[model samples]
Target chain A: MMTYKSEDIKKMNSIELLKNLYQLNNATMAELVAQTSFSQSSVRSILKSLENKGILTLQNVDQSSGGSCPGRYTFSKEHFQILSVFVDEGTVDLKLKDILDNTIFHKHIVCSLNEELENIIITITEKYVVNCISIASSGVIQDECFYTDHGEYMTKHEIALNLKKRTTIPIIIENDVNSMMMSIKAKQSCNNLAYIYMSETGIGSAYYVEGNIIKGHQSFSGELGLLPYQNQTINEVIASKSAKEVLEDMFVLILVAVAVTIDPEKIIIAMKKDNNLSLTKIKEGVSKSLSKRYLINLEKSTNPLEDGLDGLHYLGILKLFDLYTDYNREKRNG
Target chain B: MMTYKSEDIKKMNSIELLKNLYQLNNATMAELVAQTSFSQSSVRSILKSLENKGILTLQNVDQSSGGSCPGRYTFSKEHFQILSVFVDEGTVDLKLKDILDNTIFHKHIVCSLNEELENIIITITEKYVVNCISIASSGVIQDECFYTDHGEYMTKHEIALNLKKRTTIPIIIENDVNSMMMSIKAKQSCNNLAYIYMSETGIGSAYYVEGNIIKGHQSFSGELGLLPYQNQTINEVIASKSAKEVLEDMFVLILVAVAVTIDPEKIIIAMKKDNNLSLTKIKEGVSKSLSKRYLINLEKSTNPLEDGLDGLHYLGILKLFDLYTDYNREKRNG
Candidate 1:
């Protein structure tokens, strides 16, 4: 359904093959075939085309493994710089990464998002020859065109589209939780998945069901903090810390909700890199009533921030590939 | 991805085509074409084949007002009898339905489940020549091979498989919540959906993500009542009526859980076809915290039981079509 309409029977397109190869890094043709389920002939032809275009490189693996082995193809193209941006409350975090995923530069600047976005795009793209700009922001992304200031009811900030006008560099923006979830999703496949980020000051959530992300009707699905608990909303309780004693209790409720309703195969609860009583308490409380089947699916992550940043990086790199592939397609058509 | 593998580029199969035609009873070729997204040629070929097999019949339309319209084809095979059984506590509800979904016989029999299952199957089949047996039961159904009484940890009841041995008819079994969900799903397509059935005595939930039911690991999902909630489990609280005043409050939490995580396009709250204090309270509480983006997705249904029965009917009828399809395929191969 990602590339083809669900009803239309379709072949694995070039982007899918590229995505698999990029994730696999240095992998033989056979490995790419297995990862993407493309026929050997199809994989070979695509690999050959990209290799001829200098977008891919092949290196022979040592026959030290039992017998003769096929050559491994690496998807690295270090020339392409991916500019990844994460919009914080009063700051924007920026990172420039190469196709090999090396962080060339990382910066955090305190500024209003609406005012600084245009400047950020110009300043970074000029400095780094950025191939793609991917933003991970916290709000409802309207068809990835604009980020609504507060949920779906607030003033619409046309961040992605406005930035696209500033430069030819492809601009891809998504909800923060969605980006974090996508980062994890890119690492491995989990049919049904829920990613929750909880910390001292903030909470975020993302969901994946079957194959695609569970983006709500208005793309405002992962607004978990807005959910009601007692007289105060979940975000209020978190910010006030008035319900600190029952914070674990509230987390239990949230986990149970996701577990029972979404029925994900795995739910990753990412807390801050540093944590205290919350994780243990949440797990213990959940274990009390949630059956072992669901309890086992609950996992704790200490790298929530890293996951979010990595998500932006992956998004930028892949989007860069999409641009390049489109260009290649145009070239072939011509 | 429903019938075809995600990786496989495949055509609209026979079963899918038949399902549309069956659901769109007395529908024209154009209607089936739209529903299944099959080509005119493909639909015509499949219809012709089934017509040759005497499973389908085409009829002429009046077209009184407009230009001559296409003939409508009906899928009313009166010979097929479907035995739909819903296992209730201290009793079993059985209904014999024809292919056109007409209930020919209905009964409520008091019996111990494990002890009387065999007797019930033998008696029903002997008297009626039932073509298909569909069961809507509570608890975990593992691979549709066995129904575990408690959860995944409980003793396995090889109901479907065992009943299949005693009778040649295809046996279809699903969790009651799933059956209700499938029933709604058959009526219309909602990409992300949650179905909640709330009654004075019991609570059940089912989820649809992307295109399929979220049947968690161990197929022990939709165990909503087991979720942990403030000292007592949800089921315990429901059973004792100890928290009757706060029942709607609890339900709001459940709804929020489903809304935020699954991010369904619609969440159907099916009450027991009666008015009470809960529904209003739930809507109010949810409205208070959830913004218009999500609150609009909440829907009320007074026909939960009907949906479940309809689900079983649809499942049984479609499965019968599958059997006939396989036989036809075999004949062609031979």
Candidate 2:
């Protein structure tokens, strides 16, 4: 959280200019001058400096889209790159990508729980990842270094000694769920949709609205596990060791009681194929218990169970666990 | 929608600069220069221009926080004005406020619906609201003016025509529920929490993360009423007339079903005082139904008799329906 000084901002603007040229592919000096509040001379001067740095290429004047006259401009993609990283307990994935979300190169490595976890992880990153380019990650990486639990393994004194040895690039660390949210934003059809990733051991949710993820203060806003509950909360029921046991108990007691009571828009039961809790069994159990409430004959009489979950049946909810691997990889590496 | 041209973007930046200044509470030229990408000269230039237009003042300046030297700058309050209109089928509430959301003045009017409803509304607005002020409303007010149905008499087309006539200020139209979401944001203790305001008429949800309300695409995302219900849809049961007529239709058929399913953190039930449906009756109804599932003793249990709804018993559901009125004005206007 470096507060911007005047000189720092000027340098940041220069970097932004390089990024914009890379993002736009090509732009005339006049276009930059018009698009930005910067004067024509300032834009020209910046373009010249960028060209000298081998980060841009000047093109001949061309006809404007509809303007009175066309203008010459500079464009380059040489210096355009993003280093994203995804970090989790024992695994870290890092990638370099373009602004278009396309990965240029990527690598995944495992950091075994050793006595020197931090030093080992940092060493691997410095050697295999950061030597030539930038890095991005799934875990919270800040200030061009890994904010890992490395210090826990090594003493606080040793941790500082290890980090000083490597030349770190600009790194953007993101949470796994946030990475998935960004991937969902890449989808063409998804608008105002929330992505809830029910992993093997945890229930995580990412809310997307207007093509951006709803990241709250401290970036821990979507921790649905902490949401209040009676008897037991959603996280306790969904992500705990006694999840199945609790479900079995609630099946007769709370599940049926509440199923007939609080009817949500869609009771999305997000799970994988390996789970013992099948949508079919859940639906069957619900039907038998709440027979008086939901008329089961609706499906047999009118429309058959269509493509999606419908007709009071615990319709097989959106299976997103399959996308978890890609989501994780993209988040850490990109 | 008018695609932002380069010229329009420049104007938007100017407006954003002005808004940011208002948010910062009249910062110095040095503060403005540091907070934004503008150079000292550019900041001075804009400050002078705005002061000339009577929108800013060259107030005394002090040393930058933790900096070596002190500097002078201008403060602007003239442009810190907002003309907000809250429109529903029953009434239109127009208010003028400063950037700090302090209301300068307000007017509430009732109008009859007709084919020319938009014309009537626009005429009233043009007559009352100041020109070139930033305009916002509890309806889709985009591109100076756009028509949208207020779910009652006036068609959106009529509203659009009037908006076309008045294009002085930058207009931002949003859903009434969205406006309520903003109001809720202003009232919340935590920025990451979700708010649900359930009234006799409908249920309004406002999701906040990082202090910004989640506005779904086309601003129609939180149409929670449209979420598919079990056996039926939310709109078919919750907000429909047929269910309301059937005494316990909404509770036994709808509200109870939702309680057992989604299990929201807190569901505030805002209702009218001395209304036909009281919280006591709702709890009694739930207690009777849930007895089969859980051996709940309403007499001995603290759940049902609580001031607000707790666990499965929605006892204090009436607080959700807020009797919204100008409380401050009632004392003054009286």
Best by TM-score: 1
Residues B1-334, candidate 2: write the lDDT tens digits. Answer: 1222233323434444554564466677777777777666756766665667555666544654565445444333334445555554455555555444455666666742233445554555566543222222334434445344444442343343445555544334444444443443333334443333344445444444443455433333343443333444445555554443343434433333333333223233332222354445665655443333222111111211111111101100111101111223334677
| lDDT by residue (tens digit), candidate 2, A1-334 | 1222333333444544543443355677765665565656656766776577554666665754665445554433333344344444466454544433345555656753233545554655554433222222222223433333231241122322344454343222344554554442332334444334455454554445443444433323344443223444445665666656455433332333322222222223233334465445555655544433332211111111110111101000011111211223444576
Give per-residue CA lDDT, model 1, range B79-156, as digits (tens): 468888877555677888887767788887776347477678779889876888888876677767545455456766
Which clashing pairs does model 1 show? none
Off by over 4 Å in 2: A1-48, A54-117, A120-167, A180-195, A207-213, A224-334, B1-44, B57-84, B95-107, B112-129, B132-157, B166-172, B181-197, B206-213, B224-334
- Residue A285, candidate 2: Cα error in Å is 18
Error of model 2, residue B157, in angstroms: 4.3
Candidate 1 lDDT (Cα, whole model)? 0.71
